[model samples]
Each structure stands twice: as structure tokens, then as C-alpha cells.
Target: MAHLSSRRRHSRSPLKAFAAVAVVCAVAAGGAYAAGVGPFDRGSDAPAPAAADQARAFLADWSGGHYDRAAARTTNPSRARDVLRSFTAGLDIGKPRLTAAAAERTAGDRVRVAFTAKMPVTGLGTWVYKSHVPLQEQANGSWKVDWSLGLVHPHLSEKEKFRLERQDTAVPQVEDRNGKALTGKAYPSLQPLLAQFTDGGGRPRGSILLVDRVTGETKRTETTFGRQAGKGGEAGDAPVKTTLDAAWQSAADRALESGADGRNASLVALRVDNGEILAMANTPATGFNRAVSGTYAPGSTWKIVTSSALLLKNAVTPDTVVDCPKHLIVGKEFHNVETSEFRGATFQKDFTESCNTAFISLRGKLGGSELGDVARTYFGVGQEWHIGIPSYDGSVPRPADETEKAASMIGQGRIQANPLIMASVTATAASGRFHQPTIVLGSKDGTSTTPLPAAVVGRLRTMMRATVTGGTAHVLADLPGEIGAKTGTAEVAEGEENNGWLVAQRGNVAVACVVEQGVTGGGSAGPILHNLLSSVPGDPS
Candidate 1:
């Protein structure tokens, strides 16, 4: 509105120009402060703090899947980059999220960054891991992270990378005598039994219990079979060999499965000449190996040991006559399985028929420890064994009273054996000497008594042979090869059901089978033994 407009405008330009210059300087100063470049300086010369900052930045990038960027902060950038890439690719987890990251000062211009990663595993939900990364300040005033495989996982080794893998390898297969596979194939009943030998990792070890018959050497091995997680620098398991006969094992499995009648049954077989196990099977194929570990009254099957003791003592010969009554009383009243009484029968005839009365009547003739000694020293009963697996060898305690002794004579009182022990008894009778049964090759041979008298053994063999031909085991008379057998119905209690048992020998193979709560030994267990023995390939006549 004044008349001097041009002069006024020219004069105000200097003041306005000065104000604009001052405003520009102030904005530049504020920007420099915000960037930590001027007044608030975090310069490269700060060694320890710089290293800590670099460590934090590296961890942040790593957790965010910026692997290349993260690795660029490491001393060995190329290797670090490759390792990071490979590890993340191999993981079965989702991208990791940084839960916490903190950098702390260490000695000599170094910094340690502790971090936690929250990763989601495919099916296992979330997994949290904590680790530390070390960083050092360089001479050039820069910081670099140390590259190590352990930076990823504490268990990782140098030249190794993290990888998600199975915990176990495949289970080792069980093999037969001819180097054929017995287990690992689909045998329904054997599956559960085989599981007992496996560990929580699902891995199976080589059968260390197998031994060579002629060499007396063992089949020991350090190899393991079954599923297990692979370690960083470790190899997988090797296959295992066994002493089982595949054919016989299969036959035994089938026999028990078919005849078990919802009850438990077990069977075991061994070579008479050498103690090599040929077959071991159980029905309801479970982790419990009843064939070798079961403890039950052996019943008349134990008469083999009793008779051996009596023969060694000259108490009675196979041809000697004995009385068989329907009922006899000692400390307790004892009765035979059959009501019919044979007033006078040869000892051989009574043994073939499994006459409990005849054997019980002679309990007074046995010395205090004679029967138990024979069982322990000659038959290897009730002895600890090293078979590369857990087993209950057997138990034969000396009876303290007449009633107990009478029951012991018939394999009742304080006399317990599994199928393996019974099979061993038959094998000993067949071989004319006691040889401890072994599943692992090269295991220590158990203690045994002096060689049995050949003449006495010869007569015992004849008596057992007559059982298959004309006695309780007559059902197996028509079987191929020279057969011998004995049947037993072990009374568990006065009123409870009895366990059926049968032991048999054919050529070199001897087998024993037991059926819990079965009708009778000859009726239930005899056929199973026959089935197993018949399947074995016999010697050429």
C-alpha cells in the first residue's frame, strides 16, 4: 500500500536469504545426528561395540532367511553362505524367527552374541534353540563373525552341516543255518518276538549268541541293525547273521499259531551234536521270549534227568520192574493222570508211558542231592548262561521233605524249565554228553559233568525211542527218520489247567514245545514237536 515497493522488496531479500540459509544448516545438522555420523558418532573406530553391532546384525539377517547377507558378516563368507543355504534346505522346519538376540563384550576386542530361534517342526510343533556367535574386530576397524559348523548346532562338527534325518537305520535281519534270512521277512507271529530284541530306536543288533558247531567259535559282531538317527560323522549299521534254520523257524511258527487256541505256546530246537539253535518260536509273537525265559514246572519231561540220576546211582535199570498205582500218599496225596494202574511194569515201559506214579514211588531211593546234582551238573539246569541275550537257564532245587521229593521225581516240586532247557535235555540224551546250548557264536561253553556212561545212555535212548513207537508219543511213530519222544502234562495247581509239554529228537535235531493250559502233552504239544522235527532235513540213510 506504500509508494516505495521496489526498494522495500530488494532490502527484505538479504534478511529472507539469511533465514533460509540458517534453516538449511539446521536441517542438515539434525539429519547428521540421526544417522550417527556427526555429534552422536558410532564410528568404525569403536572396536568392541562395533563387533557387537555386527553380531546382532548378522543374527537378525540369519533368522530372517537373508542367508547371503548374514554370511557376508563372517570371516569365511563363501563357506558360511553355502553352509547356511544347505542347512536351511535340509531342515524339516519352517523359517526360523528370532526370539531373542543380545550382544555382550568379551576379552580383546571380541563380542559374543547369544540368540534364540523359534522354528516350527513339520509335525512336532515348535522347537526353540539357543546358540552363541563370536565376533571379533578386525585391524581395519571392521567387525566379522567367526564361521563354524557349531554355530548352527552344538553337536555339529567341522566340515559338517545340519540335516534332519531319521533316528535309526533298518533293523538287522535274522539269518538261518544256510545263510538264509529267517527274520525281517513277513512272518506275523515272529514280528512281536523279534521286537523284543530291538531297542527304542527300532534298531536290531547282530545275533552275537550264534556259534559254529565244529569250530566252537562264536558269531560275535559290533554291527547293529535297526532304525537310528545318523550322527554327524558316523556310518549306518551292517547286516547280522543268526543260527536259526529259516525253514524250521517258519514251520515252528506255523505250528504254534495254528494250535495255540488263544493260549500261550512256545517252542525251541537245537542241534544235538553241537548246541546251535535251529529254531525258536512263540505264539502271540510278543516281546516276551517265553521259549527261553519262561519258568514253569517241567512235569514228566524232567523225568529224563531223574531217570539219569537213578541209572547213575544203580537204583533201577530200564528192565527193572516197578509198581504203578492209581494214587499214592507221601506228605500229600498224589494221583496219576490216568485212572488205570499197572501193578508191575518195567521201568522202560513206565518211562515210555510217562507214568508219574512209577517215578514218584521211587522218590525214597534218591539221595538228598542226587536228582538236583544230575540236573545241575549233567543237564545244565538252573545255571546262569551268557547267550548274548537275557535268558533264564533253568532251576532244580533239592526237595526238603518226602512229599516234595515225590513231586520232584515227577518234575513238579521246585523244578522249573523253559522250552530251551527241555530241548537241551533231549539233545544231551541224544548226544550222550551235556553241551550248553548257544545262540551266539563263540560264547563261553557252560560247565558240564563227566561224560555219561555209554551203556546207560544206550538204554535211555532205546526207552525214548519206544515212546514214539508204542507209548504216549505214538502219534509221531509214522514220522520220517529215527524218532524218539516224551510227553508231559504238568499240573500247575490241583484244580487249575495243566501245561502240556513234549520233547523229541530226530537225527541231529532235538525240539521241545509247551502249551499253557492245554488238554494233555501228547494231545496238544506232541503234534507241534512233530511238525517242527518233520520239517528238518534229516541225514541220508
Candidate 2:
């Protein structure tokens, strides 16, 4: 039965798909992602040459994930369907690749055919085995595969079946760029992500065995995707490598632990050059991975996009004077933090000071859909990103009302983001281009964004520099390096406390974090960002 599992029909009816390629192709390829190779017997003298062809076609339908089609080619259709489903589904062996040998000729009037199946056992290695089937002639002058319990597995009779049982569900070690094993205990913040780091959370990874039905005994041990190695049950899947830097991960964890003040918080750091995730950490680690999955209003950190839109449209320059009032009403009321007014301020001062009214006053300078369009086009907002893991790619829908538009100008209302999105946003602002953030370096990942204009990039960079040096993010100015940052305090509800946000880029690292209900971004998330930034070596991140 194990050997029979190896060869499946690679072609379909009339077997023209098998006309040229035959057993020779199957044996030559040696089954490394080899599928769809079929058998061709030209003018064979076997008494039931057509019967062998029927059996070959039956295996083809079976290996193609068409169980009912394969069963239709069998004499006992109902029984064949049930056993076939149980064998593949129960064993958790995926649609296997079957390599069929040419028809076997029996000296008498009967005919039989043999084949090999390369069954890819889920979360385990492939099990290669061979099996054979007898073909019988029907009254209608047609040949069909004889189906029985033994047809599914030679060892499986009417009283026996196959079982893939779990023995150890412990996940294998995850490695870093240097192949150093990274553990949850050594880096508690990564506990929530380690299992998924391998292949993004599927069936459990552990020791599994195929139980033989007759005696209920087991044979063979396993690994996942990785080649089988070692003696007995000691072998396992090779560790998957990620781009994470352990030292930066440790520093990011410590920063959150000490700076989050026991509040629910999440932080993420990535290389500004390639968008490779360096560290992802959450306080009170192990429940939810808010660092990448959670969504909240980015508050003022969204102003980065807002500034880009305004600059791209030539609405305002860094020195363009814009009025900042204690209260400015577009439809509803909007005000600066603490309702403190900067009577006459440049766009730079308004940005550094985080004046809600200052930015809201220019809402007329943008169309309701302009902001959302620019966000999706340049920032990858609302676009699919396959980061080798699941994540809620942020949403930035167009405003529904004047109030929503005013609120969105300051990163509220319908605008939503997490540390993951904001970290990428910061990276885009810093580099003038965008790269989809990815932890598993080999995962299918790439992005093409129209580069932010050079004039806009320079203005935004220096304006953010002023923010760190003389405005809201001054907490980071005293640390070191030329840094650009934005702070935000997002309103959740009328009575509830707001979520804080800060996203920035310094040297080669772009970092972002959120402290839920922590009041202001600078005061809450800034310290955490500071600690992480201070740890950035003079070398590349």
C-alpha cells in the first residue's frame, strides 16, 4: 500500500495526455514535485489491454482530486468512493502524484496493473509506496477497475483502515538570519508569532505516524517539506529561517516591557531599505498579536499621508502659512490638543505641533476621495500583502460627511492602521518608496509604488526633523541621530480614553508602536520608540 501511494494517473480519458510520456518519464523524474506523468502502452498483446487503460485512467481521476470521477471508473462505485475518500482524507495525505507502470500481462484471461503513489502527508514527509489493481470486463463490453477495501490500501481490508495520529504537537525551532534558534522563553514577545513564523499557522507541527489498519500498528516517522534524514523517529523538518535580528528583538521587547507601563501596547521595527521585519513585540505577550493584526486610528501618524497629499497637489509648502485656531468648524467642531491655538503657523509648525484645526482648515484643498486614493496608490493601503502570514491590511475609505473628512485630516474617522502598517508607512516616507513588510524573506513579496516626489520627500523629512528637534517628539531629539517622527492621540469614544500612536524612521530602521488608552502618542508610545531607536547600532539595521 505504501509503494502504491507513489504513482497516480497524470493524464485523463482516451489517455491522449499519456500518449507520449510513460513509465519512463515517471522513473526518470524521481518524484520531486513531479506530477501529471502517465503511462502509454502502444499495441500491447495483453488479452485485456483496454482493462489496463481503464485502471490507468481511474488513477488519473483519483490523483487529480476528483474522487467521484475515479470511483465512476470502478465497478463498485459506492464502495470505491467511500474507501478512496477515507484513505486520502483520513491519512491527511494530500492529492498524491501517482506514477503508473505499463499494463501487467497475466498468462490467462485476466489483466492487472501496478502503480506508485508519492503521498504528501500533511505536516510530514511524503510516503512512497506501490499498489496494484485487477481489471474486470463488464457485460457492456467496457472495462472498469475492481474496487474493494484492499483497493484503497493493500493492507486495509473490510475490517481495517489507515489512521494518521498525532503524537507530538510541539513546533520545531525557528531560526534567525545566523541560524540561531529563537525561543519564546528567550524572547517572550515573539511567543505569539513563533508557530506562524514557519508557515503561517496551519496544522500542528509534530511527530505523526500512519497507523496500519489490520493490527492498529504504526510505521514511518516524519518532517514537513524538508527532506527526510536521520535514523528512526529522531528526524524532523529543518528549521525555517527568518530575517529577524535577535539583538534588536531583545531590545524591542525590553523597551515595551519597561515603557508600556503595563498598558496594552504593541511595537514593530523593520529595515527601512527592504521592509524586512526586525522585531515584533507586544506587552502582556501571548494573547493577541496586535503588533501586526490589530487595527486602530493612527491619529497624527496619518498626517504623514495627509502631508503627502497636500504637497503632491501643491496645496501647501513647508513655509505655507496656515491658520491654527483653538476652534475650527467645517461641519461639526474641531480643535487642537487642549484647544491651544497657534494663531498664525506655517505648515511645518502645524505638523510639528499636531494642530488638528490647522490641518482640518485645508480639507477644502483636497477632494473627499483624493486622500483615500493617494493612500491606496502610494501607501499600499487596502492592498493585499502576502507577508507569509495573515494580517489585516489597513483601510482608508473616503469620507461620508464633512465631519468625517475633518476628522480624517488628522488620522481619525474612517482611517485605520496597526503598528505593522504604520511601520511600513514610516519606511515609505523615509525612503520615498514602499516595500511590503515580510518576515520570511523567501515568501512571494514585492511592491511597485510611484515614488513620492523629491520635493515632497525633502519637505516632509525636514519637517519631521523639526518635529523631533523643537516640537511634539522632542523626547527623541535628546537621544541621538537625525530622526523624523509624528505623534497621535486617537479618539475612541466620547467617554473612553484614546489610543496613542507614533511612527518614525531613523537611519536604516523604521519603527512604530501604539499604547492603547495611553493619552498622547509622544508621551506614551514615544518612550518605547526612543528606547528602541537608541539601541540601533551605528551600522545598518
Candidate 3:
């Protein structure tokens, strides 16, 4: 009998809807993002016979993700329904459409067939939304569909459910670069605190799920039951090697607990090269992994996208100067910075200072759709990311008027982003290309690469570096090593400070921190970063 875990449950809600949004967001953002060839246009000329054969080969290569291989692919006559359910549910499939159809016959009188079917919910728009699947010829010379397409299921079997004991659970592990175990029992003393996680009403928020970044495995053992327990709760044997430093997580926890002033603070760090999240923290409320989940106004971080728009069009240069005097009136609206000193400044200066007026003045240089495209492509706003924890989709502010563009340039208007996305923008610049960022490393499906231009990344990196060295983030200059960062402060209701953000990268570690309703990002977030960096094993080197 196939052992099923007690926690196994099913939901009818569409699972692939999220993936569709992510795919559409990625494609929309990469706007005309030269495919290096062409869009997977289903309109290509009739596919050759070899193409059909190739499709069959492709089907055989996919490994199952959401189902137990032993159970899913079993030829056992007794478990046909179980296998069928496991395969179909694992597909996590929503509505699908046929994009292309073709067939061919190979040697030995076997028929081979290839067709592209799209999961409309994965967000490729109707145009590019199709997926290519290949079918092979059975012994009777009839084509049979491969089972890999069934990996889209919204629910998994009892064995595939996410749990510590489940053999199929494959989340990643977290450890320091020095080979020290930061997770598991060594320092899982916080599990008990996490188990007690709750809302103001004394209701359970949810179980704390520790994710392994390297393997994309989820270790979902129950959180520890008490504080100061002699031994840590079962932290689980399945370890995930993360890019985050253990000491940094500890420091970040203390900093958030002490300095948040009753509000919440979420911080995240990533490696530039591969989008590996280093350190992340959501304090005051331990269960909320706000780095991936919290959504708030981007403030100046949106400038990163606006800058890409300008560079992509070659309409402005780093040295381009303009007057940022107080505010610039655009079509009966006004744009200004928190400070009034930028009446006259250049693109480089405005960028370093994060001047709303200077950036807004350049709105006429690019259109709203163009700005959205760049924002979607380069910074990943409005995109759905596969970070281990849940994240929110940022609003790119489809401007209705030129003045709205001005507002967007200042990171206001309709713009909002979670800390997780901002960290991705910074890491893209640091990495010299745009790569998908994830909290859970080595995800089961892995990451997809987009060729964001090197020159575009370089230009943005230079601007961001100035912020840390001499502009808004200058306080970070005192840190042990060279750091690149930007700060954003937004105004919300009832005089609350709203959101304060600092996205930074030092050496291999890239980080983003958000303090909800903190007066200034530079003031509180800087020290948090300093302490986090200092606590890491290789600080100041």
C-alpha cells in the first residue's frame, strides 16, 4: 500500500495561475527583449520529420517534480487510479490550448508525433503561451502522450505532500561558506518561537516552514515547543545549503526585534551571480518572511527601472544635467524630492541623491508602456518570482498621463514592490545580467535566464554604487567593505512613515531590507546591514 501522510489535502484553486502570471510578467518585462532568435512563434513553416522525433526525445527527458517517481511511474496493475491521479494532479495544469500540430514516422514503422500545447495560465499571453510536448510510438505503432506534461497538478499524493518525513520532499539546505552548519539543530533555537507565531487575535498564523535554498527542499517538521529547551526541536535531517550567513541571520533578528519600534522589518540578501538568497529576516512576527511576502511602495527603487528606460532609448546619459529645483510641473502635476536641494542636477547626481524631480523631468523621454516594459524586464516589478516563501506582485503604475510618469519616476504614483523583488533588481546589476532570484535555491525546476544587456546592467551598477559611496546611502561608506546600496522613504496615512528600504550587495552577498513605517531607510536600515555584515564569518575582508 502507498503510505499517505495525514496532512495530505487537495484544493481546487488554480495552481498554474500563479505560474502564468509569472511567465507573462517575465515576457512583458523583457519587452522586445530580443529573443536571440525569435518568439516561439507557432506560425513557423511545417516542422520536419526529424522535429517530431526530437519532440519524443524531449518528453523522455523530463523528471517528475510533484509526484513520487516510484508511485507516479509505477507499472503496477493495482495502482492505475493512484498513478493517474498522481500524474494528473502533479501537472498542476489549468486550461491548456494547442499551439502547433505535427507528426512523423520513424524506422521500424513506429509513428512519432510532436505538438505544442500551452498552459494559458502561465502568462505567456495567448501568443507565446504554448509548451512543446512530444509523443512516442507504442509497440502497436500508435502515438502515446508522455506523462511529464502531467507535472502541473495542483495537489500531490500523500507521499508527495510537503513534510519532513515525506521521502519526496526536496527543499534546499542553508550553511555558511566556511562549511559550518547554520541550520538544522546547531542554531534552530528559534523553532519554538516560530511555533508560537500568531496574529493579534491569538490565532495561529501558520506553521514555520524552513526552506533549503540549494536543493529547493522544504523541511516542514513542527516548530520547537518552548523557549530555552535543552535540545532544539526536530530541525530535520534534510539540510538546505543557503548563501545566507548564520551570524547575519542572528544579528538581523536582534536588530529587527529591538529597532522596529512596534512595526515590522523584513530583510533579504542574495548572491549576484546565481540569484542565491543569502540572508533573510522577518522580525517582530517571525512567521512572516516579508522579504518575499511584504508588498509596499518602492519609493526611489523604481528609479532603477526608469533609468533602464532612458538608457535603452539612449535619450539620456549619466552626465545629462537638469534642474530639480523643488518640483517640476508636468501637465498640472508636480514632482519633487523630500529634500529641496536638487534644483539643478545631472542624471548621475540625481540618481545618487534619488531626486524625484530630476527623474520625473525625463518622463517625456520614454512612454508609459516602454517604462513598464523596462521595469518588468530589468527590475522584475509586476512579476511573480518563485522564492521559497510567498511574494507579492509589484505594480508598475501604468501611467495615464505624462504627470503620472513623473510620479512613477519618483517611485510614487501606483508603484509598489516587495523587498524580494528589489533585491533582485540590485542583484541583476551586480551580476552583470538579469537572472531569476529565488529564496529557495536549486529549485526543483531550477531558474530561467534572460539576457539583460551587460551595458544596461553596468550603467545601473555605476549609479547604484554612487548612492552608497556618496549619495543617499553614504552612511554605508563606513562599512568594512565596499558596498552598493540605495534607500527609499515613502509617506503613508496618518503621518506614518510607510516604507523604508535599503537594497545592498557586499562582495558575494546582496541584500534588501524594508522597515515598515520607519522614518528613514538610511538611518535604521544602514546599521542593520552593518551588524549583519559584521557578524558574517568573512567580514571586513
Question: Which candidate has the top score in lDDT?
Answer: 2
- Local accuracy of candidate 2 as per-residue lDDT tens digits, 1-541: 0000001211111111121111110121112122222454555554465676677668767764567888898888898888787777777654455766666666444567777876656444356778876777778888778777666556666554455554444455777667778899999987756655543323234444445556766654433443222322222256767778888888889999999998888898888888888888988896456777665778888999999999999999999999888777666566666667787799999999988888988999999789878877888776767565545466665665777778788887646678888999888888888888887767675555677888888988998899899988888988777888988877654434667788888888888999877878888999998888887655343
Most TM-score-accurate candidate: 2
Q: Estimate each model's TM-score.
A: 0.61, 0.64, 0.58
lDDT of 2 at 245: 84
Q: Rate the local accuracy (lDDT) of all candidates.
A: 0.64, 0.70, 0.51
- In what order do the candidates fall by lDDT, top score first? 2, 1, 3
- Cα displacement (angstroms), candidate 2, residue 109, comes to 69
Count of residue pairs whose backbone atoms collide, per candidate: 25, 16, 37
Per residue, candidate 3 scores C-alpha lDDT tens digits across 19-47 of 21122222211111111111232433433
Ranking by TM-score: 2, 1, 3
Worst 10 residues of 2 by lDDT: 1-10
Model 2 regions lying over 4 Å from their true place: 1-169, 200-236, 539-541
